[model samples]
Structures are given as C-alpha cells and as structure tokens.
Target: MTTTTATYDPGLIDMTNEANKKIKVLLELRPALDGFAGIPQEVRLLFRGLRKIESVDIEGLLQTSHRRLARGTSDTGFFRKKISAARRYNRISNVIISMAEKPYRNVLDIIMDYFQKRAEVASLQISMVSGFGKIKLTRFESKSFEDFTWRTIFSKTLPASDFSLVAPANHRVCSVPWHTLHTVGLSTLNWRSTPKYPKLDTKGFDIFIGQTPYPARVDPDTAYVIRYHDAIPIFMPHTISDKSLHQATHFYAMMSNVKSGAWFACVSEATRQDLIRIFPEVTDRAVTIHNMVAHHYFLENSAFERVPGIIRSRLYEGDPSKGIELLPKFFSLREKENFYKRSLGDKHFKYLLIVSTIEPRKNHTRLLAAWEVLKADVDPDLKLVVVGTLGWEHSSITKAFSSWIDRGDLFMLNAVPAPDLRVLYRHAAATVCPSLGEGFDFSGVESMASGGITIASDIPVHREVYEDAAEYFDPYATMSLVKALKKVLYEEGAQQEQEQMRQRGGEVSSRYLPEQIIPQWERFAERVVAERKSIKSSTTTVFEEKNSSVSST
Candidate 1:
C-alpha cells in the first residue's frame, strides 16, 4: 500500500458545472460484507434517500414491476425474503412520484460506475469485466435502498446507520454501470469524499472508492482513495473485528491503507485529528469533512404525517410551557397509531426514550442503572422506551433489559419504522443519549430536531453537536444521569426549559444541514482529480527513466 505522497486541500474541486464534472472512477467494492446476511446496513440504508431528482430509476421507482424470491433464502426465510423483495424494486414508486411534496430530497449528484468485487478492479482495467458475490450481486438491481432500510428495521436486523450519520439524505452516489450487477451488498457507509491513494494490479482511473485495499504490489500509478471514518481500531486494538485483517498493514498500511501520497475525505475534524495523530506526515493528505444529519427527515418537513388530533391527545400536558405541539407534519398517522397500540397499548404513561444500538460502548447499562434510581422518585409508571437493535458486548445489559421488560417497567421497540420513531421522539418526555464515544452523536441532535428534550452524555462529540441545546451529564456516573433525567422530567418549569432547549437544538442542527456539507464534497472531488494528475505525471517520468536504463543495458 506504499506510494509517493501528495498534498491534499479541502477547498479544491472542479469548478465546471457540478453535473458535468464527472471523473472516471474505479470503486473497490465489497457489496456483501455482512452486518447480517452479506450486507452492511450502513451502505444499504444510504441508498434509501435517493430521490427521483437524483436519478429517475434511483430508489428503484421504475424498477421491474414483478417481484420474485430473493437470491439465497429458501421458503423458511420467506418473511425476510418477502421484505427484501419489496425493497429491491417498485416499493417506493408511489412515495417518490406521488407522496413527495417537499424539496427535502434535493441532494448533490454523485455519479460513478460501481465494481462489486476487489477482483473487478483488476479485471475492469485489464479485461473490462468482473464477477460479484451471487447473493449480494443480484441485489444491485432488485433491491431498493429505500426499501431495504425500513424492511431491515421491521426485521430487527438493521445495522447501526442512524439518521444522524445522514447517509441517504446527504449523498446521491449512483453507480451508473452498476445496472448489470445482480445485487451485491455494498459495505461502505461513507464514500462521499474518499479520494486517496496506493497501487493496484492494473490502472485507469487514478482514484478508487470502495472497501478493498489496493493489490499489494500494484502499478505505482494507481491511487486508491479511501473514505476514512475513525482511527479507533488502530488506537483501540480491542475494537478490531475478529473476522477481518483490514486493520493489519505494513508501515504505510499500519495506521491505515492510507499511505503518504493519497487524498482522504475524513468524516469529522475529530476523525482527521485521529489520522494526523497516527501519521503526522499525513496532515496535508487528509481533510476534515463533517458528517451531515438527515434534517429533511428529522427537521423541516417529512413525507409522512399523523392527524393533529391523535398527536394532541397523546402528548397532552396541562403545562403551557410543555414543548410546542408536536409536529404532526412528520408522522404517518396509521403507522404512528399502530406503533402506539403495539407499544403504549391503551396506556397514557409518560416515557423517556433512547435511540441507538444496545451495546457497551453506547453506555446503555449506565442509563438503565440511572433509570432504576430515577423511577423510584420520578413516576413509577414512567416507562423507559429503548429503541435499537443489539450490538456486541450486549450481555452486560441483557439481564437488565429482560428484567425491566418483564416487570413492565420498559418498552423495547428494537427497530421501529422511521415514522413511528418520529412519533416517539415528538411525544416522549425527553430523549436520553449516554454513549461513551462516537464519530458523531446523531441521537442527541435527532432527539432535539424531533422536538424532544435531549439529555446527553457529556462527551466531546455531543458537546460539539448539541452544545448548550442539550442537558449534559457525566456518562460515568449514574447519579449524574439520574439527576439530569430528574431535572428534565420532574423539576418545575422543566417543560419551558425543555421547550427552549429544543429550539436551540434546532439552531444547532443548521451546521450539519446538507447545504453546509455539499460544498466540502465539491471541493474534495476537485482536489482528488488534481492530485491524481500530479502523481500520474510523476509515474510517467519514472517510466521514461526505466525505459532509458533498459535501452542502455
């Protein structure tokens, strides 16, 4: 993965019309790397936000009408297959064509031809062909990114691509030549500004965007640009996946596949700092591009709506200072009602909400412990509403979750639909986020945008994202969280304070809006092309020198 390092700048990109500024791209993709069943939910959910404007067939609105069985599953996995089948084709046509009434889906166009296998990068360069995983490859055309998102949600297997990570609503990357691939699982969650480098067996495009590393001994001319998320695995070796060798590389590869000469688009300033800490020399090769929030879904306006009456009745509070009437413009009435019936079920008890993967790093155990103390004085009927699928090291909280559920003290909505989630956010007494670390803390921001009071772990990322908009607590101390929850829930004038906090939270969200993010991407694309050309010229000189030496020999 070694290469001649080059300078990278965040303020560079082709100034030509954005629509016309297309680069010859070679994406190194691993479509079937599984979060569960050969797919990374982060990348899949990203496609769900593609609007009709980005590309007509995107969202697969015009995908073939008839649905069939998914590639690998048998009749026993029928339910899962059915959900997958609907998502891959035709499911979102109505929503885009008829129901889409807002300009929220407007996003920057990212056009590229996708390659499903690592081998494809070589074949496409040398032979103009490649193969992909049978199960995941076929899904390229059949599976709709929009459908896969919610279907995975209902199936309770959706990986942790929370909206705050802002995949779909922010990006519009459409793989043009990708039409032929069956449906391979795209494993990357971020590729928006991944222009960076190394070598490959064959060469055409100077840059590549995908999960696979460049072939070990590649043509020095090939530049592999990787989307850098975090340096967590390198610093915290324990977090590295037991199944993969991606974290293991030589000197240049030690810190990352990122070598000296490649351009990288990091997800946050914090992430850029992580890269810099490992490779101080990479200061010029990396630039910080903050992650965006799906403001369209959580703020402004949304496609779904519930009746005002239903919302008013459910969120009824005699206090005038209570958070403003929940915005019904965002919820699907039927969906919200059904969710309520299933979760709340004829009960009118107030609830506190937490939306995130249930794992140790997320610090859910502490939240549970805090709730144990808070419930004693706060209202016995106040339910802890936990939303999200389980993640690794969840055994620590399994007993706690089970005991609470069994005692009817908590409601576990593992993977509710987007609309139902918005409903919960709007009506909940307040949302809690007690994570220990994160590349970005979307839950806190999302809770605020959804008009819920957010009490977050006083982590740097949370402070960066929520600032004074949220009530902060020491994540390590259950008492701190208990106190914060108490102040937001039981303390007098809490409603007015929360309502004001929600407004400030809305203001904070503006920074992560897509408008604020798109310019960073445009500049990133520009620098990538400029650097590639510069390195390619250097490679040409090397070739000329080699030829002269051969002639003399």
Candidate 2:
C-alpha cells in the first residue's frame, strides 16, 4: 500500500472547499465499482464515497475510519491502506488548515461562558427531576386551578426571595420554573447525587425546594426545604398496597432533609394536619399555604370559544348516546337530538358536565346507575357528558359505559381538548365531580371559573378550593348526587343559585392570580432561607462544643 500526499494552499481548503472536493472525488470514483456488480448498488456507492474522502481532513478521516470498520475490513493489508491514507491526508497543507480550525474550539470553554453569563442575571437557581423528559414550564399555564395555584406560589413567591427550586429530574410540577431558575429544560434526565453536586457555584443556593424528602446522608452544607404537594396517602390508598409503609417511608425521607430546622409548605390546612399526624416530629416545621387559582380563568373572556369540531369528533365518535332522549327532561327545550343541534341551538347548552377519568375513584359507575334511575322516573331532557380518559384499577366501574353504549340519554367522551372543555364549562348548567377522594379537585374549580355552578364531593380540599360556592355531595350516596343534579338541573330558582355560585367562584379564584400568590411565595422563601441559616449556625456551635469536650477528656 502507498500513501498519497496532495499539497494545496492552506486558505483555499476550508470546510466548504473540502466538502466540495470530497463530493467531486465520489462522483469520479462511482464507475470504478461497476465492474464487480455482485454488491448492492447502495453498498457499492457507500464504499466508493467513503474511499474518496479517506484522505481529505480530520472529520473526513474520522468518517472514513468509521465506514471502513463498518464494512468488515479485517485484513492487516486493508487496515494499513486506510492508515497510510490518513497520514497522506494530514500532509496536505489545505487539509491541515481545515482540521486546525475545528468548529467547537473547546466545549468546556463554551460551558464556562454559559455559567458566567448566568451569574450576572437576577436568576433563581432551580433543579428538577427529569424522568419523563424536560419539564414543560408552559404547561403550568393550562394547569387546573389546584395545580396552577401551587405553581404560582412557587414561581413568583419562592424564587423572588432567593430560594432554589431543586428536585429529581423526573419531578414534573417543580420543573415549571426552569425559565426563571436558569436550570436546563426539564427534559435533561440528569440527577445530582450530592449537595452542591451540580456545583455551578460552591457558595451553594440559599434554600432547596423539594416535593419528596431528601435521602439520608444528604450534604449538610446546603439547606433543605420541603413542600407537600398533596397528602397522597389519605386519598390514593387504593393505588398503593400498604398505606402505612408508604406514609412511614415518606415521613422518614422528609424528616431526613429537615436538619433540625427547615421550612415545610403544604397545599392546604388538611394536608398540614395529615402531615403532622403521620410525622409528629416534623410538626413544628410545617406551615399551611392554601392553594389558589389564576384570576383569568374566572373572568369572562369573549375570546374564549367553544370546543373545536375536530376535538369534539374525536371525543364523541362511536361512544354511547344513551341519554339523548333525556335532554328535553333536563332542559325545557330540546333543540336537536345530536351534538350539532345542541351546539347550534342556543350556542350554549345549559346542561350538566362531568369531567373525570373513567375509574372507580371517580365513581362513574354509580353516577351512571343513578342517572339510569333518574331517566326512568323523570322527563329527561338534561344531558350528562362524561369527559376524561379511562384510567386503570376499576373493573366494575368501567362497565357502566359499556352497558350504556347505545342508550341515547347518556354520553361518554374521553379526553376532550381544553378549549372545548372551557366552552363546556361556560355553557354548562353545572359541573359535577363526585370523586371518592381528591388531593385537590380541578374540575370543580374550573367549572366555577367558567361561570358554571359546581357540584363536588364533600372533601376538605374541595371546600378549600370552592369554599361555599359549590354544592357538596357524599361519594357513596347515589341519591344525593341525583338530588343535587335534579335541583341544579331543573328546580325553580336553580338558575339564580347557579349565577350566585359562579359569582362567588369568580371572587375566590382572584386570590390565586400570579400577582397575589407570587409575593406570598417570595415571603415564604425568605423565611425558609433565614430559618435554615439559623439552624446551620446552631448545629455548628453544638459540633464545636462536643469536639472541645472530647479533646479535653
């Protein structure tokens, strides 16, 4: 084998020039492989193209080396041929210039630039769990009133006061503040194992915000803060095998990060109580912050439109129409038999809307059963539209939908688009969600925001979100739901009652606006930072005293 060296002017052979040369070589060499046509055309073309660029430059050399190995070149003679080609390519003065000015001068240098730029900004430092992908900060805008309330508190309040938002890469909710925090998008699945692990700056952040408690032996150097998103144990027990063990583990993990003095924020007073009950030692650390809904949702916007035709089609196609005939009974006017007629008649259907995943916890089965009984007894014009996906863990619960597949008085729609949902809420006679349990019922408040009367389960979270603006019902009592539905749907003065509730819902939802909640978050964060600093000083003093006593002994 012999190496070929071609010397050319250095300035003339840049990336573009080299690339053009490689292309010209490939075009010239294509006919040479035709004599041995046993190989596929693609394979032959690839082989010739790689050989043409083998002596061009570093990038070309690297690409050629990869191609030759992929083609199964085991012969020492063939290896020597490629190696000689690489040496010959380096000797080409033009090729040397092209390789010398590599695109990325130093990756580390670019990263350092990013760090320095960030240091100059009035930024929040936040770390998030990224298991699913980048945390979508924008999704917070569309969050249900419950989630939105918590989000506003964290993003506006906490960060303004210099608290750092940190969580596992998979933690979805906390990652919403990435834009403010200067953390990379939530999609990056990088987890830091130690305190100051990301180590952007050794001074360390003022406070660390986490949903789950930190593991034992966390770096003592950084202050740990915990915010309880929900009392999951109280509501989601059926979803877990052993509630006690889960609570115990959760309690242990949360306390491990407390370090004798740390601030804990909870979504509601009920959640704070539950946390203290489960972890008595951490009771002193907890503070209750009632969740809030954004004000815009509660305000009437003329720009808001009804559900789109395509989304409505996707949700209602092939689904049961059991309650179609009952529309006249629920509402005095039955304009049309199908959705098109109902949508076209008055532009707003004053009917009940139920938003929930089709599962047992949502009590869809009993709701359906009660609806069936009501349909048989009443005139039946009011419509019941069930929206949301069919989640798992409920075998008996899901059967009700299947049973009512052809019935005209009932309707089941899974996963309707948000715009349509908003429209549905605005036009609804009332929005009803009688869940067995809920961390914070989003549907009820959203319904209220849309100026619809809200009927919900008698849960503490619901009370906090709805206050006295919602009609409450017992989850197990089918008749209670039926009575509430009938009253809201058809009783005299029902419309007046509905309007009053809507007004109150609008008033209550204002507190959750970004402006109101953001400042509160700022104060909470400042307090957490101050408290953590005090605790650290005390711990240091105790450690020094113990060391002195041991040394004297």
Candidate 3:
C-alpha cells in the first residue's frame, strides 16, 4: 500500500472533530430498555430527538419527529451506514485519525480518549454549555432562571453562543421568540457533555453561559460564565422550592471549576451589585446584561397603539366582520362567551393586573390583604386579575385566597398566552410586580411597554430598572400597598399620572429593546473571543471528578 493521503481544507479537520463528539454523545443516548420496554415507540423517538439524534436515512430527517419515533428503527444496516457516514464526513487528506479503520472497541476507546482531552480543541476558547444539568441529573425543575421566558427571548434577539436554548417554546408567548431564531438563521448548538467529559474538540466556545450555574469542569483553559440570575434562593430559603437547596448546593459545587477566568451576564444592575457584594472576587467580571423585551412588542403590537375595540371584538367573537379571515368552524357562539366570561367576566370592568407565578416570594398574599382592606372601603366592583402558573409552597396562598377566587372578586388566569396577555396589559389600569426579590422583573416592563402604569415592590432591582417610572411600595407592610393602590386607583389626576407613566414606559423600556440588548451581547461575545486569543489554554489545567462542594469566590 502506498503512503496514501488526500489534501483537504482545515474545515474538514474541524468537521471531523465535531463528528467524533456527536458519535460519542449518541452512544450515551441509547435508551435503557428497562422502563422504555413497555412504552410507546413515539415516546422513544421523542427522547432520541431531544438527545440531538438524527435518522439513518436522510429521508427520515424530513419526517415528523413523532412519526419517526412511533415507527422505531428495525434495520441494523442503517446503524452501520450511519456510523460509516460520520466517519466518511470526518475524512481529510493526510489525516492520521481514522475511526473507520479501527476495531469497534478501539473506536470507542479512541473517541473517549479524545473527549478526555477536550480542551485541546481547534478554537482559542472553550465555552461551557449547560443542558439543564441541575434539573436533568437531579429531577428538580422548580421555577428558576433556567425556566424563565427570557431564555426564549434571548435566543431570538441575540446571537446564541454556547448555553442559551429552551428547545421547544410551545406556548404562544414563546413561539414567536423561539421561531425568530430560524428567521435569523442561527442554530441552537448542543451544550450537553458526554459521560466521559464535555466535547470541546472543534469550534471551541468563547464563553459558556446558562440561566443557571454550570461550571465547565475541564480547567482554566475554558471560561465558565455563571448566570448569577438571583441570590434569593441563597438568602430567602423559605421562598425556594423543596429541591432548590439541593440545586443550590450543586451550583456552589461547580464554583470551584471557575478558575479559567469566569464572567457573568447579570440580569440587572441590582443583581450585579448583589453578586459583587457576595463574591467580591467576581466584581471585575460581572456585567449588567438586562433581560430584554422582544422587538415585536415595540414594533407591531401594543407598545404604541391600542387595538381597535371593533376589531378586537370581531376577533374575539369569531365574526370575521372587520375584514378579518374566517374563524375555525369549531369556534362557536357559546365558546366566545366562555372566553369573555372566564377572562373579563359577564360585566366588563377595568382591573389591576399582577403577573407572577403564585409563590411566597411574589408577595401576592400581601397584595390580597391590601385588596381586602381597600375593597371594604371603596371600589367594591374593582377586579384583580392575577395571571401566572401555580408554583410550589403555594398551599397557604390558595387557602387564604380561595374564597376571594370563588367570590369572583379575584380572577386567576394561569399561563395566559401572549396575545391575551398583551390585551390584558393593554387595557389594565395598572400592572404590579410585588416580588420580594428578582434578578430583573419583567411584569412591570411588559405591562409598561403596553402603555400601562406599573407599581412594583421597593426592591433594589425595581428601583434600578423602573427609576421613578413606577410607583414603589413596601411589600412587607399591607397598608403600604393599600396606600399606594388607593393613590393610583382613587386619587384625582391619576389618569394623567398613568398617561405620563405610559410615555415613560416607552422611554424607560427602550433600554431593554432588542436593539439595546443585542449590542451588549455582541460586545460581550467579542470580549470573550478576544480574551481567549489573548491568553492561551494553560497546560497545567486540572480535570477532576464532579465533587459537591462550593468553592469560595
């Protein structure tokens, strides 16, 4: 045999490295036949898709994931062909690496060996990716920054680097933002690591970021950018989920892995300050990257113009009379009444809106207490619309407010879609976020963007973000909220104040537009890339087992 070699572009070498990593990742994803034994084939397919899987036949990629998952794979030849294709794709002239030529056992070992030294990748920096490791490994999915809507919005407005993705934002509110990525032509890269180690072979990440804390464990060669979304879980233990303590412990354990010059994407200045106050070592690296509002809000939707009442009713009533298209046949007269009655009730009335999950930290109970005091004296017909989903540690909240909900004075719309939410925010007299703590509150911004007055808690983040644009009140004291509520609801010239606040909403919230946040993200990514080039990956980097201990900053 002649010493054979084929010349190829450096890009092929990069592609080969990525292929090896992908193949190694697939090996770990072969669903255990134990519980999956009796499950439907559709379920198997769903899991496979989520695990970043592809079909053996190129045609299979075109099929609906559910259909493919339902059919399952029967051809052993397909697996052989799939592996062969990846190896073929990896081929380049004069390259010594050959997964195809090796024995199966050697191939597995070779792939494992490559991943073991993932830091020796083509790129200058290794960006750590987080695939909800905290939730996946622990089965603890209590509402956190990883579960926030900002994750979905960030993907659309900003170019995703290493760690941001919601996978499937099925909710209407999330659908537009998630799909916006495709319009922008950016793929959500996988952030998951194999059982061996993270696959940082080709296309080394400049910076790895997740909505939660994920320390890239290989060493100082990689920059492990932690999402310091909030410090409430550490401080307000009573307000967190039962498994949150376990999650926090896991988060802190990964802090030791941040030696390679960590950075932070702070949600607000107040959050940045809190981070610095707690971890002085990170003061230099922390940056205030405010969670942004979607451009759609400012462009075509409710930012400036209120919807025409005739058109709004036509859409709601399914009449199609205002030059709108025909409604689905299933949409009936009775359903329209149900939609209106459930949301707005039989009697149309303006209501105060509170958009937050039903949890202890939201201060809904305090708001309710204020409502009770205010309702007894004035505005008997005033309604309180609370929009959000049920959260943990909320039994007492439901118990206390159950009667109010029953009496119809308090209306709760859980997981209201974006269109309906826009309407609510558009028409609501005011929107309030009385949370005890937050990384960056969206309720006030979302509502304020829709020309609604905002009243938030006296929390530092609220002050920093709202800054006189919103009225503030003590969330702890019942009367404090009552007094503030009365001044806004009953006080004279309050309409003028709301109009003024509406103008300020457009002004203040401009800071959170995609135009604003996108540049920050670009600048941040540039800095990370430049920083990576400036400092080479240190040779003495430490690679250790997943130890569960929080390292001091």
Candidate 4:
C-alpha cells in the first residue's frame, strides 16, 4: 500500500477531500459600474472579499443592464456601434408601437407592428446565443478596467497607502444587455402560467452569482445564486422612481429566479423574510449573510476643524443663481463668513448629519423639519449637513433646502470618499438614517463603526441591524424624530448613555467585517456544491438500477 500526504497552502482553504478543485464563480459586475454607493458599494465589497478566499476562483461577468455590448470588438470599440444601432432600431419600433396603440390604427399599421414584434424576438435570440460558445473574454489589465476595479473596490473605504494595482485576473463580456434578455423573457409572462426564461450559455462556470434576480437561466449543472437586496419596488411601488417598469422588472425577474431554483443570499434576516413571504417554498434555499462594512471606518481621533473643508470640497454643485429668489430676508455676507469662522474653531460648532440621497423615500424632508425645530429650540449654533447626490423627485427637497443653503446653515455635499466620510462620521453630533425602507441600512452601522452615534427610523431592518447601537424614531412623525434626536444628541445627562451606545456599537459593527462575513460565504458555497453532488450521485444510482432491471427483463 502507498500512502500519500497532501500539503496545504496556507493562503487558501485546505483541500484534502476528494473534490480538490477550486469552486469557480462568475460574479455579475454590472452594479459596480454605477455610483460608489448602495448596491455598487456592496458589489465591490463582495468582489474584494471573495478574492481573499482561497477555496474559490472568481471572475467578473461584464454585462450592462441597459446597454448592449458589441460582439467580436476591440477594447476601444466595444459598445459604440451597437448602441447607435440599438437607438435606430428603437426609433422605428417606437413609431410602430405608437401606431398600434392608437385608437385609429389601420391594417398597414397592424401589419408593421406584427413584423416589428417578430423582428424583436429574432434580435433577442441573436443577441442571447450569438457566439456564446467561443466568445472571446478580455482580461482586466486595461487602464479603463483597472481604474474601474480600484474605484469599485475601494469606494467605501480608504485603500492602503502602499497599494498599487488590484483587479480580477479574468473578465468576460456578454453581448446582450441584461434588460433585453430580461424583457424578452417577460414577454412570455402574459400567456404562460410559469413564464419561460431566456437561457444564458453558461458553459464552463460552476456558479453564476447575480446581484439581483436575473431574467436568464443557466445550465442545470451550474448553481445560480442571487445576492437579493430588497423587494421595495414590489411592496412600496410608490416610493420608487419608475413605478410600472421597475416594479414589473423586479417582480418578474424574481419570479423567474425563484422558479428556476436560484438560491438567495440576502443581506439581512429582514430581507430573507421578505423573499419567503413571496415564495414560501424557497424558504430552504434562502439564507441571511449580512453585508460587510468597509475596513476604513474604525474608531479614530480627528479634529472638527476638518469638517468645513471636507464639506466645501465635496459640495454637490447646483445652480447657485436658481435658488437666489429663495434666499432668506436676513441673509448677509457677514453671517456666512461668521459661519465659516466658527466652523473652523468654535467649540460649540456642531452639525446634524444625514447621509442619503435627496429622495422622497429617504424621508429627507421629515428630517429637515425636525432639524429646523432642533435648531430653533435645542441649539441655535447647530447646523445641518446633507451628503448625497441628487436622486429622482428631489426638486421639492432641494427647494425646501434652498433658503437654509443660501444662509450657510445647510450644506449639501456629494461624492465624498470613504476616508473623508469617516472623519465626518466621527465628528458629527449624530448620523441619522431616516429611510422609509431598506434591506440593511448601511449608514447606521457605518456610523457606529466610525465611533459615531446613530439615530435611525423605527423600521424592522434598523432593529435587526442596528440593534442596541442606535436610537430609533418613527419615520413618518417629525416630532418623534425630534424627540429621539434630543435624547441622543442634546438631552441633559445623556452623555453616559451615549458612551454606552458607542461601546456596544464597536462590538456590533465588528460582526460585519470581511474576516467574519467571508467564512459564511465560503460555508454557503460548500453546502451548495455538496447538495449538487448529492443530487448527481442519486440520479446516477437510479439510472444504473433501471438499466440493470431492463437487462434482466
């Protein structure tokens, strides 16, 4: 007998078992192309965390949701030609669709609409399967891709000072836009009981993980996983930007993913419960593995003097003259100068912070109302700082903010990098998360991680994620938030309670670090692979037994 000992590599997981091959994962990279926050931030963090696990070899699948990628194109000419062609086709299709929808549509118009629908199906098929088997994959060493990689990976955190280059080794582009494939699949939903999903040629990949519910199907041999965020568009349609299309896309894609045996890795228990509420059968397949907080947000000592500079430097540029009419009657240059001077050195210079987009669902107006009351009664020196880019339906919020902004009492900042945001978090009187809904609100945990106090809406996710680390208030009631703010930020004899919350926060936030979360992902992947193997083994055994019985007969 010969004995063989397998030496393990310390960097990766020990693979001494029968199946020694590394699990290959193709992670969708579409979300990372957007702004450096929300889903994009989570996608980037997942990529970075997955890279550190030795048991898995992961590559990025580059496919835009709304933009078509050209096939067999050089790096320089990837989407330009396809986009122009798509736009031209869209114009013609729109004309036909408009004619068909009109009350006085003629036979000619009806014929054209039928042909147009046929042409769309044909185009969708071509886009989906064209050159799928031998599709050429581009590497990620290109300057543009490298820049994109770094921006995505380090968006929510400060990169190491000594860090130079970091990117995935392999990346493949899919010619069909995700939306096209999704919509084509959705065309079947009206007639079929179970909507037929468009198929993706997932040839060699062992696993395909999408950031949301994908509208395409993978091979039965491959496991498809969704990093499910939330079903906001389904439940709270009024809050989202595009009610009809967004809700349909999310609900239909989710239905397809569910029917196709796709596993879900939700960011919170609350999110997982939402999934189960829709499809009870998928309860076994869905699991909760919380999001990873950036490594940049540990407790740090920083001066309050830096806040003004950070805000000014990152201020979201708006039409300075458009809101001039809304400027206060008492607005004066002296007070503005005095505000800056006091922010630089005054001991009483404190600001209330809200880090979210200027959107209705974020409940910015409610927070603003509460802040106004606090300013008038609690502390006149208290300023309000809002940090986020402009989201849809923000005209009213911006309008409400115009007078305060002109008076230098309100600041709107955007594109703040993680290091600067960390400083802001640490020095602020309190960071407020006043969202109407969320999968796992990042701001509150992030504030806690940065040694800052948090006041969040009294939502289920907040209770689950923030726990003892945050003060809670009713999202709908302005007075409730005002009362919570007083207790957390300004009430007498609350310093001891605040200090206790900070201590609890440090411990709570540590649960979301990469080192802690990555193991959960690894274990989930292993379990999925093990189940696949068990199914395969059972199928083979049944097939062999049937063959034996047939031969005897």
**lDDT for each residue of candidate 3 in 492-515, tens digit (9 for 90 to 100):** 987777778788887887877655
Residues 369-405, model 1: lDDT tens digits = 8888877866777777777655666555765676666
Let me know the TM-score candidate 4 reaches against the reference structure. 0.82
**What ordering of candidates by lDDT runs from best to worst?**
4, 1, 3, 2
TM-score per candidate, chains pooled: 0.61, 0.55, 0.58, 0.82
Q: Each model's C-alpha lDDT?
A: 0.50, 0.46, 0.48, 0.74
Which 10 successive residues of model 2 have the least lDDT summed? 57-66
Task: Tell me the tens digit of each residue's lDDT in model 4 across 1-553.
Answer: 1111111112333323246688888888788766767788888778777777788888777777665443222233323343354443343333223222433346975686567456546755553445122223333332334444455444444375413423524565665667887777677767666556666656667788988788777777778899999978878899989799888888888888898888898888888888888899988788888899988789988877788788768877764575523223347888756765654456547888888877999999999999999989978878888988778888999889987887678888888988899999998889999999998878888899999999999988888888878888999999999999999877887898789989999989998998888888887777776677778789999999999999999
Output the better candidate (1/4) by TM-score: 4
Best by TM-score: 4
> lDDT tens string, model 2, 295-367?
3245455432353342346444432364322122223234234644444344433356788766667777667
Error of 3 at 525 (Å): 0.9
Give the Å shift of residue 274 in candidate 2. Answer: 1.3
Candidate 3, lDDT over the whole model: 0.48
Error of 4 at 136 (Å): 9.0
Model 2 has a clash total of 36
* Candidate 2 Cα outliers beyond 4 Å, as residue runs: 1-203, 212-217, 234-236, 239-262, 294-296, 301-350, 408-417, 543-553
Ranking by TM-score: 4, 1, 3, 2
Runs off by more than 4 Å, candidate 3: 1-203, 218-222, 299-348, 537-553
The weakest ten consecutive residues by lDDT in model 3 span 56-65
What root-mean-square deviation over C-alphas does model 1 reach?
13.7
